[model samples]
Target: MPAPYQPAGVSVGDVPGVAQTAPRPPLREDLNGLRGVAIALVVVFHVWMGRVSGGVDVFLVLTGFFFTASLIRTAQSGGSLNPFTRIGRVLRRLGPPLVLVLVGVAVATALLLPRTRWVDIANQVVSGVFFYANWELAWTSQDYLAADPSVSPLQHLWSVAVQFQFYLVAIVVVFGLAGVLRRSRGVHRASPPPHVYLVLFAGASLVSFVYAADGTSRLQSWNYYDTGARLWEILLGGAVAALFAARHPRPTHERRSSEFRTGRTALAVLGLAAVVACGFLLDGVNEFPGPWALFPVLATIALIAAGPDTSVGHLLRSRFGLWLGSIAFPLYLWHWPLLIFTLAYSGKPSADLATGAAIIAASVVLAMATVRLVEKPLQAPGGSIPRIAITATAAVLAAALVCGSAGWNFYIQRSVSDLQASDELDPFTYPGARELTDGATAPDADVVPALFSAPEDLPVTSVEGCIADFETRDAISCEYGDLSASRTIALAGSSHAEHWVTALDMLGRDRGFRVVTFLKMGCPLTLGTMPMLGESEYPDCLDWTQTVMSEVEQLGPDYVFTTSTRPREGGQGDYTPDFYVNVWNELTSYGIPILAMRDTPWLVKDGVVYRAIDCLADGGSAMSCGMPRGAALDPINPTLASSFRLPTVRPLDLTSALCDGPICPAVVGNVLVYRDEHHLTATYVRTLTSELGREIAASTGWW
Candidate 1:
């Protein structure tokens, strides 16, 4: 559907003639049709193709163009430029449908989603109501625990938030100019001159453009939803509006000259081509809201400048296009959640073409129902400030009630779990290492402790703030095991390596060796650049790695422990990349014995990472939540092959303890094996202390 700020029933043909220097241009049917096309691209790309359609960029431009133009016209015509009236009109138009969707999603989540996901859904619902969902996603993007494939139903609201923010900014700019004109000693006008507005728009656009370019390069995932980074596109629309306002007044009875029509037609054709081509050619996720975004922004401007007189405009203004535009906003809202909920229930990474078509059909029906029943009635001509305010307040309160209930339930569950946990359980009943090595059957799944079922049930390292996050550049070292031990074993690498620290710490404390951790989130001790979220190079990780290695060399630890291999695509077994070999060689040069542990099996099915806890919460059995042993690991550890040629680099594989003969269970010895997809839970890792100690002693003779 059209942008949240797009005025209902107000087309180019309906705008009243302004008594300014230039006659105001009528709203074009073609622009509305363009909005229809943009939303179509977005839905199709998000649902069937799993790509961004660049349609949101087009919508941003249109929102800026339409809203700014209307405001400028109002100011020039000596009409009231009251922010409250304009903002209220926008709120009345957008709020009802958005609230409807939010409430619908809340009900769907309760019925379809597992209880474990309720907290997140509730948080997103609250954010969506307040128009800060983008910032919420931005903060969550940095959290490693929160990173999952289960897309939030409210994720698409980020664009709506950006548009809402822009509306506020537009109101301020327009009214601020009007107030300035009134205060001036000599200049007495309803609005500032067109040039003044143009200068301001240009300056703001330039600043925002630079920030977007730089921010996208550095922290794209966070910047992607940032309103500040998105202002340039809106300002470009404002600039277009200013230029339209500055046009020379045309005679009321005169038609456009032939030359003007010819130029407009040429522009319309090129503009249409550019808009269509952008969806196909550009990679929206990787290169957008930056300098590369200029292509779509410019094309949209050309189309706006072209007006609705040409053949291309005629096509855009067709009945089909107008209908699509009419339902565009609600369609955009309904489609994503429908797609995501369908995927979750179907237990598929993505929907097939037929399934996708059914989803789109369902979305269209819902959108039409919402537009007819909710959006149209509230946005009718009699909408007043008090009415709109009361409705908005009711919507917010309803959303708050849903979110509050979810949060309260989450707190209650966590409290009950905490109280139930006890240190008095029998060691044999909870036998971790003994059951695995002794071939004893594990306790019943129902009898197993509910550890690792929630985010609060994290490993000691995470709970104690030992493991660093993405933004952390400085090395955070923590000591574990026997403090007075003469021999020191250094653990270094990413979170994969950090997961093994619990076992190592227990082993060291028992056998009298000091354990020092040098861990960075997502950063392994490899020479090559690591790929961060969105496939961008992590400069902080690379720089941090260099510093870490330098410190490790100076410390001259007797043994350095880290993960050595990663899983290959298509379940082809783990392999050590060249970077691992380079790091091994560097460590060996310092005469530091390298204990290269094999990485854990990531729980993945059909290329999507699945959390064991989520599967369990959804009533899946241990075997059902687990992958085949062969699918996750090679028969022989890949690190073993690399270690064969290097005397100091010894490979350690505990797959035998973590997995059975053919199958890898989610839980071993009544303990949940993984905290999320790959990281081993501290409870499970502690159970491996005995086995781990035996292996390290055999390899290093430290004990």
Candidate 2:
């Protein structure tokens, strides 16, 4: 968990802003208690509801508030800001528990996770150690093929990265502004005027807010992890702190007035209520860092402004709250990985209520132990900056070593797999798709080479710029098979439709028909806009579909092949979506026949998608890893129903070749069936060449 801002205390007495002549305010135990409450909400919401709590937003505000106040106070007291000293303090507070947790998670992953997942976990460990997990996730989110039910244990570290980034930015801004003020005045005043800081905060917040709001609407997945989009929440806290500093404290007589007390009490109560309500009322994961984040941020600001002696404040400062707050950082660090590992081990996407409670209980115990045994000793008083720097450097080196070893091992495994694939093994034992439909027994699934290919082993057509990604709009044409052949077959659609190109390319070479591909990563040939993972409209896909349709029409291919059916939500079997129907109707009007291939079974079970390599590496045999035929597919092809009404549309389904009587095996004829959750592997598809060619010849009468 990202650490909450430490309240002002004797530890920071040397900072420039404190007035040596006047007694400083006592450390705010109530704010610490607030941090405890925030962590509680975060853990419970994550474990039981699988949603984000607005707790992180509150912490971001508190972090900005305390950090800004310290800097402003230092500037006011005529002390120059020391970036190294400040950053060292922050590292001492955050680094120990984070490193401990990373090492612990790495050990846990090695013990519990499958071999196939080791590389990903290692990558995450390195990224988290270096404070770049958010950037890594942003890149991963853009890949449509990377979606999986298995959650990374280090996913929570994205917030930690954001917090560290803010710390760096805040330090630079404070020092830079103070230097400018000194130069302009020619006389060193303690600090710049409060109004100057206020103006700067306002401008920064407005820009960040607008960027966040607009980006959320356009690309929420990218925005979710974006540091720029989240700056306003922290900046708002700085603005509040500036306002508080500008006003001198009231006289004792005025401060003790009954009216003042009543107003403060009332405001504190309302603010506390709002803070608690946010956790329950809003879906923080979906609504946040955007304008919707105001709920939690404002509630926190209200609580801070209400001061410490009110009823709500007293409750927050109670023994339980203070204790929770004390351990909040370590608790946050331990809980997420524990929860994710528990779910993975249990083979459940979400834990039941009892299991969730147990997980929370376990996390609390581990967090307490971690703080007492690891964090406290490292952050003990009199620790030198040089010592801390050495420790941090050592930790980074250790993480890099682990990551490097994992990458080397992964490369070796892939190299071996590639080498085996390139060699000609006995065709009888490694009999591709022939064993599935031709009564040949598949070799034992355990001993098969190339049983599971890495993501890089996808078809050349799928990887080599032939398949346009989400951001690409223009159609990229790639020719395969017999380029000189007079007859041409156009393959156009998403990766699902593109997977069959391996088989079609082989057929073209033998049958003298040129194969032209117009492939996009995840976009099907549809007139309607495709909805992306974050519920944002895929305008690029829509625009690209129009472009491809025109290109295909102009090429005037003998036959255009594309997927024609999609699985109905919360229903059995597949159906032709209206978008597919619209495209087919238009294509047939041009008198060019449409080859509507039935889409393959997606290996999703009980809402959790299973990856073939993960299943195989987790000791699952072909029979154990395969999905039930009835669960994955309808008994009859659904596209046949829609195609019968259209004269130029021909439905070609090869489900029998992919599935046996009751099971759709992950490995058919000793060849891995899927590259990921939904797309077929090139190796398996290539084996379907003979059957696919025969079907096309019969339908088009061109061979």
Candidate 3:
């Protein structure tokens, strides 16, 4: 059987569009046209979508084209492929401007950002400079996205990281193959065809792309930003280059041939249409660089094949196109930081027409100057001076990143401690903490019960395990409550459950109840759901919850308590309130009472977490450091409250547990309420035991 698709093959001594009879080679206007369109598409898309610019796809294709073209030329002339020389050339060309922008961004960040945000900015600077920003992003996504006013200035470098890594891998693969081919010249020409390299790379890229498409809904938090998961985009471009170089094109002189003007025009129109489609159709929340990405990639490939003699090619090769192409690199460099910074500082994200215009204009001017003065000089033959200057500058930038982080840490220690001293609320006298921990406050009693100390052994019934679920524990091995205990209570949810451990353990011991915790990070207990950060169907969440419920139902728990809301954007939108209702309905079906605790306030206003000390140090008044109770619980979930009409469910408002009359105090009763956002600290939870103990014993009539 014939293969699925035959890739373009490498044929020696075939230059597609150069007139065979001509003496001096003219510029490939067609290639320049391709560059112009690609860059323009990228700029337009980024300015609008705040999404990945398909322009990156264009750049990838161009990289493959140029790199392959150079290698083929060198190979035909019987010259050795030198990886070091190539890398040196790339560095000399791309490094100076990159270093300057990085340094400038660091300087700007240091001057503008608050102390609370310094560590993140410093780490991002290091990651961006080292070409590992993608990994940094992936790591952060585990906790949160850069959806804050304090987002790093260097976030745009994720693309650069992807490109740099791709270059390294491509160099090794291509050079290794070239060396082998030369050695085996005596054996056979067609033994392992040169085109196979491109074919294999393309096949792998397509597979990964499909994986990315399918994986987005499931692993958007982790794999969305991971370099390993994103490698396919870069590989796709490289594969295109290899395939194109491998092909021996038809003679261009004959007008009636398939490669003539009419054919080229048809392809160019299709390509342009694809570009327009991407610009209009692609948006945030769509699965990207997956199947939907074919519009941009196929369009780019089409334009590349439409030779310079065509009308569209000629237009693309014109002065305007070339000028935009010239500044494309710097344009891309400056646009994101400019937009992100503007949004960060403005305090309001509503984009105005004038501001957007100003940003675009400023970006253009900056790109023009950088390309003309900075990029051009470094890319020139005797660019050694600029390279040295850039190296010195980058070293300064690296030092600044380190010093800024350390200095911010020092500032937090000095200033926050001074402010902390002013907080004179007595720990022993505060009724909330005192009453909650009254019975369990003794340091002598083992606060944490033996059963709830570690993860519980939840039973699993399915053959499909949690391989696709990276952080989810198998139910078979992770159970929580002991059925033998007369008073059985289960803690189940996300880290919210983990945060309540100290209080729960204390309550369990004092009340003589078994506190079983069924928890996973980001994976809250629901009637139905999958693990938050992986591909496995969260049949486990439902399964685990169902099993726990069965156990709880059989044993007849006094109360099944869990936090039901988190402080998010505008202090609203908790995980599916409907699901919470279903869970309540399920518990009531088994005659079990439910006590749903309202979520604690996050310290930072905009959903980003900040160290309490850092917040106090950064000129933020005590009020701004944490959400006020009214602000934190503005839009309450009435749906959850409605379930309490069943008489078996109750809403245990912990709003007062960590809050004053109106303000949700960051610290309560002289103790820090949280180690991070939304989760009570183990230390603080100990303090809450007294108040919680009194309330639970009184409310449930267990006294």
Report RMSD (Å) for each prediction in the order shown.
4.2, 4.1, 8.6
lDDT by candidate, in order shown: 0.77, 0.77, 0.58
Model 2's lDDT to the true fold? 0.77
lDDT of 2 by residue, 97-204 (tens): 777788788888888888777766777787787778888777777321111238788888888888788778877877668877778887565457777777787689
**What is the Cα-based lDDT of residue 677 in candidate 3?**
49
Tell me the lDDT of model 3 at 355: 70
What are the clashing pairs of model 1? Answer: 1-328, 1-329, 2-329, 12-26, 12-27
Task: Return the TM-score for each candidate structure.
Answer: 0.89, 0.89, 0.78
Clashes of each: 5, 5, 24
Per-residue CA lDDT of model 3 for 182-298, tens digit only, reads 777753221234486677678878787877776564556555566655667667766766675577655556755655678889888787677666656764224454566666777
